[model samples]
Target: MPRYDFRCRECGSTFEVSRTMNAASDPARCPDGHDDTVKLLSTVAVGGRGAAPASGGGCCGGGCCGG
Candidate 1:
């Protein structure tokens, strides 16, 4: 399951929900029991919290200099 942020335009409230990827884009009902909710664009951090920073150097990380 993945967490998704939703905003209810009907009530002007925001909420989060954890659902299967299959239903990630499904319409959401606000806590106030309102519809017209929309999914928010989220900033996803790969590797979870406190994960190690990616190693390697070079602009492209391939060390080929992109040439």
Candidate 2:
């Protein structure tokens, strides 16, 4: 299950809910029992090492300068 963030416009409180992707658009009630809420756009964090830089004899390292 994925967690989604929602903000309650009635009480001005933020909350989270865990549900399936199919019901991601479903309305969520805040902890304060506020039904008027809107889902917030969340950011995903990716973890992993970046790709190694290209190696070559050129200004851009990829032989762009005809090295």
Candidate 3:
């Protein structure tokens, strides 16, 4: 399962949910009980991009050291 972040337009609430990739695009209900929620764009720390690379890294992963 993968985690997804979502924001509710009706109540301006933010939340996270764990679901299968296939269902990742499905509409999510906000924790505040709002159904008008949209998926939030998340930042993935790919190797060699985003933040500074680890001391022994091949890509920049904040500190994940994926490289």
Model 3 agreement with the true structure over 25-56: per-residue lDDT tens digits: 99998887889999999988566556664475
TM-score of each: 0.64, 0.68, 0.66
Superposed model 3: Cα runs more than 4 Å off: 48-67
TM-score of 3: 0.66
Candidate ordering by lDDT (highest first): 1, 2, 3
RMSD of each: 5.1, 4.7, 9.9
Q: Estimate the overall C-alpha local distance difference test score of candidate 1.
A: 0.89
Q: Which pairs clash in the backbone of model 3?
A: 48-59, 48-60
Residues 31-60, candidate 1: write the lDDT tens digits. 999988999999866787779878688776
The residue ranges of model 1 lying beyond 4 angstroms of the native Cα positions read 47-67
Q: Rate the local accuracy (lDDT) of all candidates.
A: 0.89, 0.88, 0.84
Cα error, residue 21 of model 1, in Å, equals 0.3
Global fold similarity of model 2 (TM-score):
0.68
